[model samples]
Target: MLDLVVLVSGGGTNLQAIIDAIDNGTITNARIRAVISNNQNAYALERARRHGIEAVCVSPKEYADRELFNQAFLDTVDAYQPGLIVLAGFLVVIPPAMIQKYEKKIINIHPSLIPSFCGTGYYGLKVHEAALTRGVKITGATVHYVDEGTDTGPILLQKAVEVREGDTPQELQRRVMEEAEWVILPEAIQLIANGRKEA
Candidate 1:
């Protein structure tokens, strides 16, 4: 079984999807040990709480600086001893400390097909906006290992979503989430849990 610690910000649709997958047996031999968030108001915390999973908020604003906050966050995650750390809409730039400790153990769900509308300065709806601006007919979501660089890690699972005619960025974003991100994130975790994913 994969012990998971999921980190999130905002509404946590992806987090909720993982939880649902666990409940529905779509993701086998995997359990969420905890959910952590930098935003105290994040609904992700509530989702975790609702599922009886430990929920923690380590707000960066409470710390002296970015490094201190990163340490605190890392400590919190380490306490859970997770086999996989899932980043589901987590907004913070990953700290070197956590990256070094977790290495390939951390995975992230990006909203774009990656190598396309990814890397630094591309996040949230901006990724979808870039795809629309570039006039790409196909854009999708990618589940990848979290490396030091942004979205440059070896890809695990990707499901493409067609960008229909006159599709707005928001529409494409929503479609990607529904058609891709929510689906692949859990599947990748399951694959990892089942010893199917490569190192």
Candidate 2:
């Protein structure tokens, strides 16, 4: 079984979906060990608590430097001994040490089909706004392995949603989130677990 540690920074709709999938037997042979967030008030923590999972907050503000913050983050994650790390909507840039520690075990869900509208400045509403302004007929979500670079990892899965002519950013975001919560997260985790077993 894969022991998962989910990291998030905002409303944890995707996190909740993962919990539901595990509870409902959609993704069997796996378990969520903990949920950690950088934001103290993130609703993701509440979701984790609701499921009787350990929830922790490791704010960067408490540390003097990025290295120290990342070290603490690594310690927190290591305490759970997670076999897989899932970034639901985490907003921080993880340090190289942490990346090296987890390597291919870390994964992220992007709001847009990557290689088109994804990078440092593109997140949340920004991605949707860019897609709407560009008048793209198709916009979607991507699940990828997390490398040191910003959203520049090997793609695992992607699902496109048709963009209507007059679709607002909120409209596009809603559709993208639906695809993310319902399909991408579970499938990506399952793929990663299976790949690890094969390796």
Candidate 3:
């Protein structure tokens, strides 16, 4: 089994999806070694706890700067010795500290088709808002390898969600999560487990 360390910043529906998929055999040969987060009160930690997995909060506010926090965060995750580091909902980026060691071992799930409503400052509902503003009829979620640039990683899988009339950002966000994000994220994990490394 591959050890996994999942990172999150908020409600961990994707994390929960991973947990459920593992339980149901949709994702096999991988176990969640830990869940790490920047927010102490993030519900993701609780989800990890419910699964009897280790949960740690390396709050950025506890550190003096981003660089320091990045070091501490990487240190904590490294302790888990995960073969795969999944960014389910993680917000921060660990560059100089982790980019080299983890490399393609890390993966992230984005709320849009990527290259469309993704990049720096485009996350959470902001992605849906951008797609709505652009009047796009189709938006989706993407699961990809984690690289240095924002959402610039090699894509593993993507599933499109239809944009309906009179859709709010919140509605679009929910639809994308239900229709695209939850499904493809776990499927991508399974594909990665089977050694599908193509972009």
Top candidate by lDDT: 1
Best by TM-score: 1
lDDT digits (tens) for residues 110-179 of candidate 2: 9888898999899999999999888889889998888989999888889988888788898888888886
Q: TM-score ranking from best to worst?
A: 1, 3, 2
lDDT of each: 0.92, 0.87, 0.90
Using Cα atoms with residue i matched to residue i, what is each candidate's TM-score against the true structure?
0.98, 0.95, 0.97
> How well does candidate 3 score on lDDT at residue 180?
97
Q: Which of 1 and 3 is ahead in lDDT?
A: 1
Error at 136, model 1, angstroms: 0.5
Candidate 3 residue pairs in clash (backbone atoms < 3 Å): none
lDDT of 1 by residue, 61-101 (tens): 99999888888988899999999999999999889889889
Q: Local error of candidate 2 at 118, Å? A: 0.6
Please tell me which model should have the higher TM-score, number 1 or number 2.
1
Q: How much is the lDDT of residue 186 in candidate 2?
A: 87
Q: Better model by lDDT, 2 or 3?
A: 3
Tell me the RMSD of model 3 versus the true structure.
1.3
Model 1, 64: alpha-carbon shift in Å?
Answer: 0.7
Ranking under lDDT, best-scoring first?
1, 3, 2
Question: What is the TM-score of candidate 1?
Answer: 0.98
